[model samples]
Target: MNYKLIVVMLFLVMGALVEGKRLANLGHKLKQEAEKVGKEAGHILEGKVAQKAADVVFNAVLRKG
Candidate 1:
């Protein structure tokens, strides 16, 4: 009876550990996707700002440098 209880407990603990690992993996994947989206957004905003800056500087210069 004691041995049976021990075996059941081990299985329960293992199942819980596996579930935790799966949750962690899902969270990691979501974070990676979010970071990728953030990077793309940053690039788009940077491109717009760079273009505007170039236009401003070009207008300021009396002659092309």
Candidate 2:
């Protein structure tokens, strides 16, 4: 009886460890995807800001002339 109980406990612990590793891997993947999306968004916003600044400068030059 004691031997059976020990085996059962070992299986439970092993299962728990496997599940924990899976969750950690999932969390890491999600973080990488989020970083990728953020970088893409940053590039898009940077382009728009540059265009707006150029337009502002062009308009100012036209007014001065």
**In candidate 2, what are the lDDT values of residues 1-65, reduced to their tens digit?**
69999999999999999999999999999999999999999999999999999999999999999
Candidate 1 clashes: the total is 0
Clashing residue pairs, candidate 2?
none
Put down candidate 1 lDDT per residue, 1-65, tens digits, no spaces.
69999999999999999999999999999999999999999999999999999999988895765
- The reply for model 1, stretches above 4 Å from the true place, is 58-65
- At residue 38, give the lDDT of candidate 2: 100
lDDT of candidates 1 onward, in order: 0.97, 0.99
Judge candidate 2 against the unseen true structure and give its global Cα lDDT, from 0 to 1. 0.99
Clashing pairs in 1: none
Off by over 4 Å in 2: none
| Candidate closest to the true structure, highest lDDT | 2
In terms of lDDT, the poorest run of 10 residues in model 1 is 56-65
Residue 62's lDDT in candidate 2: 100
